[model samples]
Target: MRRPQATPARVIVFGAGATGARVVRMLAESPEVGRVEVRDPDTARLRRTVDSCDDSVTAARGLEMPPDADMVVIATPTGTQAAAARAAVNAGASAVTTSSEISETRELLALGSLAAENGVALVVGAGFMPGLTCLLARAGAAEFDLVDEIHVAKAGTGGPACARQHHRALSSLAIDWRDGSWTRRSGGSGRELCWFPDPVAGRDCYRGALSDALLLVPAFEGVERVTARLAATRRDRLTAPLPMMRRPHPEGGVGAVRVELRGRRAARRHVAVLGAQARPAQGAAIVAAATALHLIGRADVSGAGGLASIRDTGRLLRAVADRGLRPCRFEGFTLSRDETPRP
Candidate 1:
């Protein structure tokens, strides 16, 4: 006798923007997903997204999620994600959010108990920086005996909404976790030179109102310092306080994230660095899609949390790499025999 095939998952994505469209396409390609629906207020955008995907994909006009959906991917703008997530969980569907905003991430984390009660998972910060960065941090931390500090930096933006959010983030107050306390600093004030993967190499990064620390601190129990920064230009810092002078491009250029971990390994100070480069929207979409698939396959994952809370970082990273967002690790040059120092 042959075994019966399991029912495919029904996934609903909110937003027909760059990331949302990409997520729909990815999910449509997955054999595990049976139906994919995209919802957005903009009818034209919604139609375009649905038309771009496979025939199994459909378009919905509003924010409401159907109760039958197995998963809901919230690719909407930052402020709008929490509500969609709430509705999805209440309707008994697992939820995934790409939101990178601090406040919004906090709001989503608060849904942990609700999601657990409903026996559904809520994965927050499933986008590029907070998503991939968190995974890299966990991967690096695993090599350390005691991680003391984690610093994450990113370059470039995704869609227009992402560009706008980056602008606002530079103007808002930046938060840092230090010495078991939170510290606030003016955004764009602490500029530091950061080296990313090729094509986005060596840019000036500054403290920003990013949510990486919120996601990472909880995952790593004894980590004392955590900070996140964004690559910015002199003009970006100068103009951050003012309204955007022009409409952001429909999509930005190559974006990258660099994660650096400092800790003690074998009683000696050690550092591990990992990074990846891609179009921000594409990277975000890949992470979100991979996360949704992981959630679908794993019945053991239930509750709301960021990528840091994920049980299997290695597996998720491998899946993301398999999807083409390959991560690069920084391995310092080894000493030659001739160059070895005598004790």
Candidate 2:
């Protein structure tokens, strides 16, 4: 368990756009973080972001070498984050990011390792789905004698503004481990899809979005069956989130994480509905809160930087428990009276 050092803290936030704006706001409210450096190339935008912060936050263009920064969070686009992380690692700084769990190509392994070897941890996929979702999966794995399988499901009508900005890195992708080699296929895998029961729509299931499935499943050495599903609810005026975008959501959207565990005693499972239709902002806030806990060393983090699996799903869920979310059990085709999925 890492402990907060002291106040007058300093953090460097890359891309002070919307997500950066929210992150900066969260840090400002924290008594532990007193100073923040928001970095972006746009002088006008950076100035606006900095002005929004109390005297504590300073916005600047061209990120200087992080000489005295305490924590470095890279919320920039994926293509840019790898380079930014390398720079941070070279500067001997700790980093937290929601950047698409290290790309499936293992491209940034060496750069990320540099941070670890330097003793500065770089956390990846620290956002809602992969970040907290993975954390919960880790926790569920803890309860079972053997985590014979792990399934991750998440569907969003749209991503937060910050996510949309980094669409190249954020959109769904097909990935899973097989025979020791990680493989990438199309997003819509040809698996026989079963309907995940729903009240409004009823049994809607397609190839689950493959965002985290490709990056996380392999992390749990023994787990064989891992599914990452992505679904969306739209107003008919809009279409599915494209395979790419350049900004996080301006409004917001809802999503959920469900983990199915096959235990020896009795098949047990835990389902958490986070980020719902009615309150997308709250959903993003829930994820942000979980990320903050991990950032401040308040909870344990599992897996390396590429992508985050909260590893302690129970713990992560607990962190966001205040979001008015709860766990419900499910049977084959029917959800018990008490087992309604809020999202």
Candidate 3:
């Protein structure tokens, strides 16, 4: 069962940085949306984003969300996402955020309960790893009656500060699902080689600690093992996090995720893989747009819950692909019970 689609007449967006600006522009391109308002402390960024969009979007500075707004998107830094999300839900609007700090997010599940009670959607971690990874896992899990394990890996190049931040974030401790409960291990300690799809295959990756799958994967029955990995070239790993480096050069990159399952359909094993060559900014924009549309009832979210889950996996994949932002591909294959897994 699913709710009827109700196009949002008004939408509000917080933050006007690179990610925020991109989300505003993409939302404005949608004809179904009515008014799109952007709020940010930086007037210059506000102006730039507003100038990029059509007349339907306006710069809303030092202002509150219109109670009539159907949805509010928070694209600010991770540190302030909880506050922004809390305010949006309290203001009676559906909320979405692309935050990397989901574990530290305060009371978001509690707010989701309130939103559900109020007939609104409150979704967190709508960005890449949390966003697309969740969707891909769900889609793959659907193909089999017994999901055995899932692994998600993403690789990309950026500035030294960005790399350092990513390293520190996941370097603390890694958690994964195993034997019906969660297990802990050292971050970047479990080294494994993975063969991603073309353009970035056969790379060595280390298990990462930060992943929204920690929360979502447990929901699936028979999912005993779940982990996420991040890979960088040896040179990039050695130099990208160097604080003394004035600038870092671009490195070849690719993002890939896969799921393994065993089911009764044919007493066989199944594998599904999703890969893409994309910038983090592009992935964030695609996800933010999908979340907005889902919140407003435009996209099909048949089995979605209070939190983030892409129930209508095909629709979500289509939405992201239709955006034409980057090179993306998907595939599903079957293997024998005795076969050794590759990547």
Candidate 4:
């Protein structure tokens, strides 16, 4: 495990939406976290979010990043993530954000020099799919000598914000990395059967969003193909054009993320799967905390660089376990050519 740091005595969280509130709660609940300030234009929400946590939390106004904050978490809309992250790094605070598509990540990457100049790390995609998926892909990639393809699939029930984001994403084109470049397709295209754990067994998932693939392609060396899919429900499929009206799933939030890597390890065809299960918010908070803690620990490291999530696979998994996610909840298995049945 990476050494815990006392440097992030305080944290500043931007936005007071569903994910932001959860992030604040997770940080405030931590004994090591000193102070947590939540900012939002909605005064009532900011107050409610701050009040929900312990005395360590306070409500703040505006999007300004706190200079004293050791780390800043941007949980605002996907569109605003780049700007928020830029502000956080400029304010001299190491930062992480849950929202950022491939394009937005490019904008965030452009700020790498600024973050470096300020002597801080700026990490994007610190939430569940993009964050955890990125970490998991990297982890799975490490076990193989050469990677040929990568696929990630997720199933979960998210809140209103998540629903809206889903609606928006599905209403548009989803892209994936193939043949060394991005390939765009309809939101619900590329249907395939995906299996999760017990609760969410075999179900039809489609290539819903390509953001994870985008992050993986660059982060995972020598990957030719990267694909990410979202579990598609009947309602989700029908409501693709009108996402705002989509009905919520009746089941209590149970979700899973599985990463599959096909590569050569020891001169044999190797296939691997790495996965985890939790509520969307819970998973998001776990990755968010892990990213924040990582930056906090590296506060004094010189040279600024922007990466998606915790780069160290072992450290990332360890951090995930430390933050209430049991190792059993996250599963990994590998299969070799000799064990495979040829068609």
| Predicted structure with the largest lDDT when compared to the true one | 1
Q: For candidate 1, list the clashing residue pairs, or say none.
A: none
Name the lDDT value of residue 158 in candidate 3.
30
**What does candidate 3's lDDT look like per residue over 135-180, in tens digits?**
6666556666677777777665332323444555445566777777
Query: How many steric clashes does model 1 contain?
Result: 0
Measured over all alpha carbons after superposition, the RMSD of each candidate to the real structure, in angstroms, is 3.9, 6.4, 4.5, 3.7
- TM per model? 0.95, 0.72, 0.82, 0.88
Predicted structure with the largest TM-score when compared to the true one? 1
lDDT of 2 by residue, 127-220 (tens): 5555555655665555554554555554442334434432322234556554455666554434333232232122223342344664466557
Whichever of 1 and 4 has more TM-score, that candidate is 1
Prediction 4 TM-score vs. true: 0.88
lDDT of 2 at 51: 85
lDDT of 1 by residue, 147-168 (tens): 8899999999999999999999
Count clashing residue pairs in model 3.
Answer: 0
**Cα lDDT listed for each candidate:** 0.90, 0.53, 0.63, 0.73
lDDT of 3: 0.63
In model 2, where do residues sit more than 4 Å from their true spots?
Answer: 1-4, 101-105, 157-173, 190-211, 232-249, 263-303, 306-317, 322-343
lDDT of 4 by residue, 13-104 (tens): 88777678888888887766789988887798898887788888998776677668788888876777787787787788888877736577
